[model samples]
Target: VSGVRDKMNMLGAVTDDGERFIALTPNQFNAEVAKHFLRAVQHEFGERLVIILDNASYFIAKTLKKQAAADGLLLEYLPSHSPELNPLESCWRQLRDGRANRLFLTLDDVNEYLSTALPALNSPQIYEYLC
Candidate 1:
């Protein structure tokens, strides 16, 4: 081990049909991250995106809503305490399963693994999580 350990905050989203989008951040989820995610999705899939999120405080921020509206995006909040309604949660579970028992010397190592691992979710076998 290099004796270097770091905590990386990440925001991720999955499409209803199994595509994955993720971002690594130095801090917790906030309006900035939320806006970045919105813009990233819009840039990837074009305008008029509808993103569904859990009851995370940042997702409920008025500033975020305003910014999303300005970006021609829509934000939908899932029912409280009902994680099963969000298909992205299953995608995260699969990510956790894939990373289980792995050891990383640096955050980049984890990020690299995730970069490869995430796309695997597009495969027929792993794609079930989004269905």
Candidate 2:
């Protein structure tokens, strides 16, 4: 649940490999958002890789297809209403329900909290859960 409020954009990425990263950007749901997620994929798995994504308008199947074509990636789509199949969904739930919800304040405050939470989530123990 990446969201923009008060000109601040909060975006999070959690890979099946359990390498989670989040960013604070001024542009919400823009090319930078897509690029950030794609960059994480490349960093973890290189250029040629397959990634499953939920059906979000910003990261829609068509948009992913176009981005994949441009980047030479293989983006896969999971069925709607089946978020359990996406490991990132669990990560998002953790962040939103467990972390983000508990510490909701100004946008800047949320971004600050996310900064600390994201890197901490990229541990081997957390990665195992994704597997």
Clashes per candidate, residues 3 or more apart or on different chains: 0, 0
Per-residue lDDT tens digits of candidate 1, residues 1-131?
67655787777776655566777787768877877877888887778788878888888889889998888888888889987776766667887899899988778898899788877764223344335
TM-score of 1: 0.81
For candidate 2, write residues 17-130 as lDDT tens digits.
Answer: 456555557775855477666766677667777665666666664655686778887766778887666555555665666464374667777777767766655333435444
Model 2 residue 96 CA deviation in Å: 2.7
RMSD of 2: 5.1
Provide the lDDT at 84 for model 2. 66
Residue-level lDDT for 35 in candidate 1: 78
> The CA-based lDDT of model 1 is what?
0.76
TM-score of each prediction = 0.81, 0.65
Cand. 2 Cα-lDDT: 0.63
> For candidate 1, what is the total of clashing residue pairs?
0
Q: lDDT values of the candidates? A: 0.76, 0.63
